[model samples]
Each structure stands twice: as structure tokens, then as C-alpha cells.
Target: MSNPSSKPIGLEIDLLETQGGKVPLEYFHKLISQLQKNHSLDHLSASPASAGEFDVVYIILSKGTLYEETETNAYECIIIDGWSCWPAGFAYLLVPPNRRREKANISGGDNGPSDTADIKIALLPIAQTRGFGRFVIRTLLSHAFDALGIRRVTASILCPIQPSHSVAQKKQVGFNTKQLCWIFEKFGFKFEGISRGALMSMSVVEGEEPVWHDVHRMSMLITDYFQEKRSLSLSAMRSFSREFPLKVVQQSPWEIMIQRQEKEKHDVESWSKRPNDASANDACGNDGEASDDETVLGGDEISEK
Candidate 1:
């Protein structure tokens, strides 16, 4: 990321971000299209691209970093991280009109914010299981919570997003859509109501072609997401402490000398508070009075003199 003034290379020059917690719908579309062009490594056999369906996407390199292919350089940070394919994905929040507070002007059109938005991820084969998708989703949630001040973000895993080779032909093994759902659930997204056969095929399906599959909607509140993250961090710290006990510090020579001096000063103060007679009694056990033993010793000393 560059200074907020400097424009990111891949992003459009005029893409507008909203005051409330979301990318404006139009600007969001522009970014999604840009990702589709630059990072979407969809195979030919994959189901036809559906940009309208998914609002967020992501692409992470299996190794090494990639630079943005650009004509000029207003942005200095051109390197896309190998670990997180962040610039690829998109997230949306949809809210009722009553809940909206964001306002922005884009393409000479002004718009207010909404409560809910959809997020999607488009992964290259190398980016899929390395937990890159999880990273993208988590980043989007952070943006929604901190930047957009959103109530919740939604995720829908439609069957159409799956490539045909993995699902039908089984040429490659792929994670089930519900399994993907669990990843977000682990991040505190709730398993919302499901829409069975909600995804109707826009094209005519002949013979054994499957048209519709269940779509799962997962959602997370801003507060709950942050709270869950804090809890997990605390839990991890506790577990680590249990596994590796903390060692007491070894004091330096100066610190040891200072501690000994303080102890001696305390002892002096305690001794000064005691009465002289009490101290003598404690030391000689005569209560500051001469007893028969003392008299005998004095008489013996006189006779010797």
C-alpha cells in the first residue's frame, strides 16, 4: 500500500471509496473487473465467469512476488505479496436504507451506503489450499469493520464457481463448498439460512447437466469478529505459556547490590525501632538487671583483684 494520496497502479484513477463502510457499488465493480482481468486464472474448462455473482476475489502466488504490469508509476508499492494475493478479491456490505450513513460521488453520481455486501474469492490453483482464501476473507472483514464501519459482511458459496474438471470429472481433488464455509465460520462468521436451488441456470441444461445446487450464506458481525480474534489470540498466548513456562529473570551485579543495600537499610530501621533495654535483654537474657550469676561473677573478680 502507498500513501492514501498515491493511486495504486492496478486500481482505476477515479475509483471512489465511500465514507461509510464499503466500496461504492460502481467503484467496487470496477475493481472486481480489474482483478478478473489481471489475476483471475480461470481454466477453460471452468464454469463460465460470473462477475456479478461474486463481489470479492483473491490471488496469492505459490512462491515469490509479482509486480504490477503498468505503463507509468504513481504508486511505488508494485509488488504483490506472495503469501497473500490481496489485490485480487472484493467485498460488499448490504444494509437497509435506514442503516446507511456513507456518501460518495463517483462518475458524477452520488450514493449513500448500505448495510450488507457480498465478498468473493477467485484463486489460482496454487493459491487455493495454502489458506490464501482465508486471508482474503479476513482482510475484507477488517476493512469492513475498521474502514467501512459495517455491521456484517456476507459470503455465498454457489456451486457454479467450481470448475467442471474437479467436481464432475474428478481429475483433481477440490475442497467442498461447505468445507470452505467452515473456514469463514472459524473466523466467527455465522452459518446463516441456506437457499436450496437458489442458483438457477441462466442457460438451458440438456441431458445430465446439473443446473442448481444449494447456496450457503455465511455472515459475521463486526463486533463479534474482533472479539473472536482477541479471544483466540489470548487463548493462543495461554497455550504457549502452558507449553513453555516463563523463567525468572537473572539479576545483574548492580541490581543484586541494590537489593542487598535495601535489605540492610530495612534491618537498620527495625533495629533502631527496638528499645535499648529490650535489645540488651534479648542479647544477654538479664532484662537489664543484675542477677545472682552476675553478682557471683562481680565478687569473684573483686577477690582476684
Candidate 2:
């Protein structure tokens, strides 16, 4: 079932700039000026077909100035100024999937980039729960399959352990490997295998030696993405249209996490105060496992330019 609106997602960078969200006038000017000054689009030359440590320099901004009209459109101020504003967040696409290159420039034909995988992601702490992660990745899928003509996208992630926190003090982006993997799952990614000690610790305390955590890897094909999107749209319509007031329940895609968290917290508090009867125990079977999982990080990746 396709969306009621018959528009196939148009996701070119130029079009994304206008419709996604408002990039500050100054920021937009600065980004274009910098790209012009540095001719940074050359970074796109890393054909997925060419492997074994290629270099590409990228510009990233620390300060995120993203605006919104509707919730699903994920526009960014993508600093690309080659810097980080907050110590914890910013998003960058590391060595994008392979491109269909011309024969004169062809090296490995189809094998080199066919299975290309490095896609690292992170976001500002404030931005994580707002559904920016899903929006950005969704846009990326469109760009990868439609614009670049990539057949598939593979991601190797260092997923973090899950967390539990009180309502007031919640953990923002870091060790959110699981959160990232979860979103990827919805958008047609499958869990592969975990690599032991594949990632160093995310702690910053003194006298803390680096602890090893496993890395999680996943991949998705363009065909799967189309199927997933169709299913999700149909599910949304069916799930909400019958029971809930469709007009009143309208929300940005990102608010799902926020609303769910509020519901979970209310449930936990309600149960915690309830009488310690078998009925209550049966009803509250480890509801503590449900916590905020909207936060994920996209760490920096260095490649040969």
C-alpha cells in the first residue's frame, strides 16, 4: 500500500535544502561559501568500488541550528566547517555507499563498492528525541538509492548497552548503539553478528581504563526499503484511523518516542505505588526494561581525501 499522497520521495541535496527545514541564512551562506571555497564536493569521489583506505575530508558543525515545518522533514545546518560544537553530537556520512562510476574511471567494476559499510551517525543531545535520527536516515536512504543509484547500504555500528534513568535526568547521546540499530531495523536493516571488543569504552572518568564493547553490524537493500516504507504507511493508517481521533492525534514522527516515554513512566509510577498483589506483579512484569531509547550518536570518521 503506497502513501495516500502519491509523491515518491524527491531527495536531492539541492531540493532537501529547501524543503527539509530552514538552514539559517548565514549558515546556509557559510556552508555554500565554504563548499565553494574548498570545492568540498570532491569528497564524493570515493567510489564504493575502491576500497582499502581511501581518504576524504569532511566539514562538520558543532552547533546544530535545525528548523522544522512538519516533523518528518529532517533538515540540518550541517556545519561542514570541519569542527564539532558540542563534545557529544553531530552527524556525518562516512564514506558513502558505492556509486556507478564511468568505465574510464572504473577500477574494481562492481565488487569494490558493492558491500561498502561505514555509516557512522550521532546527533545533538537536544535533537535526538525529536525524531531527527529517523528523518535523516530516511532521507539518506532516498539519496543512496535514488540519487546515487546505490543498490544497498551496509552499516557497522558500535551499539551501547541499554539504560535506565529517572524522568528528570535522562541520558542523552552516547553508547546508543542499540538505539541506532533499532531504527535501522525499522527501515529495512537486519542484525548481522557482533564483534567482541570491537569498540573502546565511552567513559571519560579518570583512572578508567578502556573497556571493550561489541560492535553491531547491519545492512539493507533498496528493494527492502521500498517494501518497509509501504508497510509502515499502511500500518500507520490502520492502527490510528480506526480507534483514535485521526485529526487530534497527528504528531511528528519524532514525538513517538517522547509520548511513549511519558506513557511508560506513568505506568511505572502507577505500578510502583500499587498494592504488592499477584495481580499487580502479573501486570507489571519488568516494565523497567522500557526506557528512553531515542538517543543515538554518530561519531567522526576519517577517510583519505
Candidate 3:
């Protein structure tokens, strides 16, 4: 059933910031506290759409932050809007240093690990299906490929077998596993396989037996990112922008890459037409790798402007 109190609307994503593992203990508490008191999120704690249905939905639903540190190389990120500073959600990335070393030991370091990373996300109920999820994933993928230079990004989505229910009265609260799989596929992530018992139960009830759930593992390589970027049409881009309605205080790595590529292309064209102009040559001296920004914007026509 559609939420009576909620309406589907564009979300204005203002910021995506990451903090090191050394984040103060109190910061987590503050975030959790703010989320718990926000009445707009009460549904997520009690409704089927609650993140608790898939993962351990704490911090906002329960008493504690559900924060844990298993990997030393992981980083936590917060998403917010610049206008009202609304906390939309949280995400984390795990980048292991040993991956490169292990690959080097096996293959003489020529191809190495290619810098693989893993990401997980948790969004508030108020932010669900508002295109904030897409924005977050896009920004993260851009950061992984361009800023961190990661070659592959992986995500494990919970896809447990849900209990059978009456189909007639069934109300869709949020994206089911199948829909989520389709969404990720559209983003160029390939389905790897099912990971049986991939996650442990995070039930808050006392004396409850622990249960495990299966997850579908999916991955996207840097090559996949490039291919998707090239294939993305102007209409699709406009749709995404309209869905998210972003007013970013900090540009995502993807946006930065686009601007850089545009500047470099302009410089090269200027130098080509003015061979005698030393300034043009100097400006275009750097052999920067080209991006698919222009091609994506122009789509089939391929614009020069």
C-alpha cells in the first residue's frame, strides 16, 4: 500500500561527504539521535518498508547506532541536503589494501588487483524512492572509478525468500529484490551469484533465535562504467536530473570529470586551429585521458558545443 503520509517527490541532494574511520564516537550518537526524533521516519521503524526488514535497521529504529568497524580501510559517508541539512541516509565503502598485494604476488604485478571496492547503503524511509538512492549510487560509483581509481565496485543485496502472503491485498511498500536487481542491471552491474547465508540476523527482540539470509552479489567494473556512460542518452540524463533535483554544494567526481574533459577538449581544439599560438599548446600540453561526457550529452548526434 502506498504511504498515506508520503508522496513521491524530487529530492534535492546537496552533499555527499565521507569521514575517516577515526570519526568521533559522539558524532554517530548525534546522527542517530536526530534520526530517531524525526517523526517522518516513524514508518520505517514499524512498516514493512523498514530497512530492518533487510538489514539491521538500528541507529534510527533502535537505540544504538549499529556502527561497527571490521575493516581498517573502510570509510563512512553521510548524505544531506544543503538547503535544510536533512539527513537522508548513510553509506560505507570497503577498500582493501591487500587486494593489490595479493594480485602482485600471483601475477608479477602487471595487472595487480585493479583496486576493487565494496559499498553498502541505508536510507531513511522519507528518502526512499525519491531518487536519492540513485544519486547516492551514481556519486559513489563516480568516486570509485575517477577519484579513487577503483577498477571494480561490488554490492551484495539482500534477497531472502519472503514469507508467502495474500496476493490480492498485498501492497508494495518499496522495491522488492527483483526490482532492485533490475535497477542495478540498468546501471550496468552484472549478477555474480547468490551468497547463501550472507548476513546474520539483527533482530532487536530479546531471546529471539538468530536467522541468516541470502544475498545476491552484483558487480560493475570500470569498463562497465565507461560503457554505460557512452550508452546513456540525453533523455535518460535529463530524467535522472529531474528525478533528483540536485543542488550540490560539492560536485561529484563524475561532474568534475565532465568539466575537466570539456575544458581539455576546448583547449585541444583551440591549439589545433592555432598552431602558432604558444598559449594554446601550453594549456593543452597535459595528455589527459578522454571521458565520455561529450558523447553522452550529444547521444547519437555527438555535439561539439
For residues 1-305, what per-residue lDDT tens digits would candidate 3 score against the true structure?
A: 33212323444433211222322335454554544554322212123222221121112111112333564422234332222233455554555454434434644434535467776665655556665566666766877787667789887676433234345322341245556667778778999987786665443357865555567778999999988876665556676788789786998999999999999999989888944546754664445634355445764476467
lDDT of 2 by residue, 156-183 (tens): 6653332333433234323345666787
What does the lDDT come to for candidate 2? Answer: 0.48
Candidate ordering by lDDT (highest first): 3, 1, 2
Q: What C-alpha lDDT values do all the predictions have? A: 0.51, 0.48, 0.54
| Model 1, runs deviating above 4 Å | 1-114, 161-175, 202-210, 248-305
lDDT-wise, the better of 2 and 3 is 3
Where does candidate 2 stray beyond 4 Å?
1-89, 95-108, 111-113, 159-175, 199-213, 236-305
For model 2, give the 10-residue run with minimal summed lDDT.
Answer: 40-49
Compared with the true structure, what per-residue lDDT tens digits does model 1 show for residues 1-305? 12222323332111123333223445445444554564342211123234322222322222333345563521122222223222333333333333332332224422545566556556533334545555555666776677767677777765434334445543232245656678778888899877777775433357756565467788877778789878877887787798899999999999999999999999999988956455655665766677667787884465542
Model 1 earns a TM-score of 0.47
| Whole-model lDDT, model 1 | 0.51
